[model samples]
Target: MRKIKELGEFGLIHKLSSQINFRASDSILGIGDDCAAYPVKSGKFEVISTDALVEDIHFKLSTIKPETLGRKALSVSLSDIAAMGGTPKRIMVTLGIPKKISVSFLEKLYSGFNEICNHFKVELCGGDTVSSPKCFFINVAVIGEAKRIFSRKGAKPGDLVFVTGTLGDSSLGLKLLAKNKTRGKDHKFLTTKHMDPTPRVKEAEILGRSKIDITSMIDISDGLVQDLHHICESSNVGAQIYEDRLPLSPELIRTCKRSSIPPLPLVLNGGEDYELLFTLPADGVKNLIRQFLKAKVLVTQIGKILKPGGISMKMKNGTLKVLPESEGFNHF
Candidate 1:
């Protein structure tokens, strides 16, 4: 048998899923998009997606609290539902619990999950708990309802690409945690953005309901360039992202400068921001900007879709070059 490390996460998934044939009539989408979708009787679609987080790989208990870890686990799965412009309804969380862990620790973790569920108005419908001899892990399955589905396949060459909120804060947070610096104001904000990510459910719901057209959409879990590449590959197009147009929080900039780290790479290649990256027709850009302004949501038009099949970055000094190959958050 071939080693899993050789295939990587996406390659392994593609290899395994290629062998299975799914032909359920009710299943409108399966195995490729962010969620497996089913058409509901009410003319809407039901989207379900699952994500998992494990000890030592995704996080470490030394840096993250148990409660925060629980919330992060659920947030990751819900973020996938958000990418479809769906309204979250319910979640099923399966836990691989270590016997050595205390009951109190587990209770705190459950409390964290409950906290986020209450905020999103999502219910914990069902899940399974099992014993783990080695390490702790969480698997969350989120089910949501979407009136208009926004998949990565809908982007066209002329579409304008936009992203919500700022980028790279989560990755910056991870860096600070690695260096054992998590007490100052900037450190706290950046680290919190990483440890307790918020799903953009409300923003996605507004966009789905808005009059402005959204061609394609995805949440930024696998870095900006890599996720945009997903849209490009699915839609059979290319993109030109402006290096200067990338949105970065004040804390991110300050932290990066202080650490002598270039913020651009983190903004482009860092993962787990959970912000929305979407495309819209050129004509709808003004109207969408107006709508976002009205909603008090921050958005930036950072790029435009291109013809052919690759990604390029336009530098601030008026130079344009092709993007290097990116391996975004490989789980293998």
Candidate 2:
């Protein structure tokens, strides 16, 4: 048998899915959804999620500041709440730091975390701290509240799929960082995107409150194509995304042109965009588009859900192409 490295991230997830027994009564939904939900009092549910960040793996101390790292650790977990159409309430953090790190650095890190928490009105309940033998590690767990939840299984055939904001900026920012070169304009915007990603909490709240009947929702922590595959596999459906209709920011276009990099790969495969991707019924598409436009968030109708099968991309030249499989991120 071939090892997981040969299959990559998505293949490993698919293989692992078969062996795991999802057997928690409290877990109304599990790995397939944005957040795992448990029933609570007053006809409401509680959501719990966690994400880990490691030194030199998820980030680097050379380029990314401790404050940005701290903020990112919390933001990624909060994105899960947004994906589930839930509101965040509280969080617990766990830290494993090397002795070489200074107390001031740690304080700055906490400042960043608290800054985001204050912005989102989330409480920091408690957490654990320890010494790591080697690299630094940070883990954050967030709890949220939801009256009703969204899952990947609800997407139906013919439903329109949409994404919040633009794609590829983070990846483009990363390329700039790697090359140790910077451009004059749009550098701050892209670098901030890579360093400190903002979760779409307000947008998610609006979507949830509107009772818009969302079929499915996910955050683009993974690449757009890879994350969409989760919805397709769970719903037993496929998708077709139009290349021309994908939302692109002016900054992203300018950065890509300056870097001489193809925009498609970054837009499709770039991780940590932290934008929301969702599906809604065909009839409600126009109204939703209009509402999103009014809100000043670009919502692009990139594709449609179809019956169970493979994903295909439509080219500008009127040809269809199968998307190559790639994993967004792998811890191991």
Candidate 3:
């Protein structure tokens, strides 16, 4: 038998998912997608997705407050619905509580959940709570519907790649937290990026309902290059990213200078940005920009889909280099 690390997270998913069978007639999509979908009624498909966050593994309780952690727990899961261009209707949460956790912490966590739920107009439908010998973890599931679902597949040769918001901020934030250097304006911005990530639900809804056709879509939860690779593999296409074009915040650049860290590596490989990475034909670029700007969301074109081959990047120095997606975060 092959070990889990040998297959890696995505590969393990592919291996096990292949053996599983689905008999549900309404099921339009299954494993290997951001969300599973099935047609509900009148051209809409109900999409569902779930994710788990564990103490120490996914986050450090020492660095994050219960309220912010609670908000992030739901926001991360909701990003899946956004990737499929769906609006969230409801959510369910499951908790694995260890003896060390306090009742007040749980209450504040749920309070955070209630606040975000109200903001998104999603109901807390159902869930379960269980005791664990060690490790506190949370699993959040969301259900939503979409008129049109954008999947990883569908990129054609000439499709332009775009990403919402800046990249690498969250990754930098994680590094800062890990080092116990949580001070300064730059640190605060980056730390907030990691702790309180915003799911681009509104942006996704507008793009999905707009006239511009989005060929492929996924959220950058696993780094920009890794998520883009998912779209490429599913579409049976490749891509070429422009390094300078990749979005970066002034805070990120300045903070990296202070820390003596290279920003590009973090931008390409850091996870938990939670921004949407998408593609459309070159012609759709203009209108997409206008739509995004009106919504006050920054959408920048950073790459282009190429004929089936390896994924590469054009550096600021004008050299092209093939990128290895394995450098990204993987559970295995």
Q: How many collisions between residues are there in candidate 1?
A: 0
lDDT of 1 by residue, 1-332 (tens): 45444554455445534433323345555655665555565888999899989899899998999889878988888899999999887776677767566655766687787777777877665566676889998899988899999899889889999999999999989988899988789999999999999999888988889887898999999899889999998899999999889999999988888889999878888899999999999999888888889999998999999896699999999999788547566665
lDDT of 2 by residue, 1-332 (tens): 46434555445434433333324344454444444454565877788899888888888889988879878899999999988989887676777867676655766687777677778877655566676888989999989887778877789989989998889888878878888766677887887898889898877876877758899999998799998998898888899999999888898887778768799988888888999999999888777867777788767789999887778899999899887547465445
The digit string of per-residue lDDT tens for model 3 on 1-332 reads: 45544554455444433332323345565444565555567778989999999999899888899989989999998899999999987676778877677656766687778777777876565565677799999999888889889899999999999999999999999999999988999999999999999999998998988989999999999998899899999999999999889999999999999879999888999999999999999888889988888888889999999999979999889999999879888999
What order do you get sorting by lDDT, best first? 3, 1, 2
When sorted by TM-score, best at the front, the candidate numbers are 3, 1, 2
**By TM-score, how accurate is candidate 2?**
0.86
How much is the lDDT of residue 134 in candidate 1? 92
Per-candidate RMSD vs. true structure?
10.0, 11.2, 10.3
The runs of at least 3 residues in candidate 3 whose Cα sits more than 4 Å from the true structure, single-residue gaps closed, are 1-41
Q: Which stretches in model 1 have alpha-carbon errors above 4 Å?
A: 1-41
Which residue pairs collide, candidate 3? none
Total clashes for model 2: 0
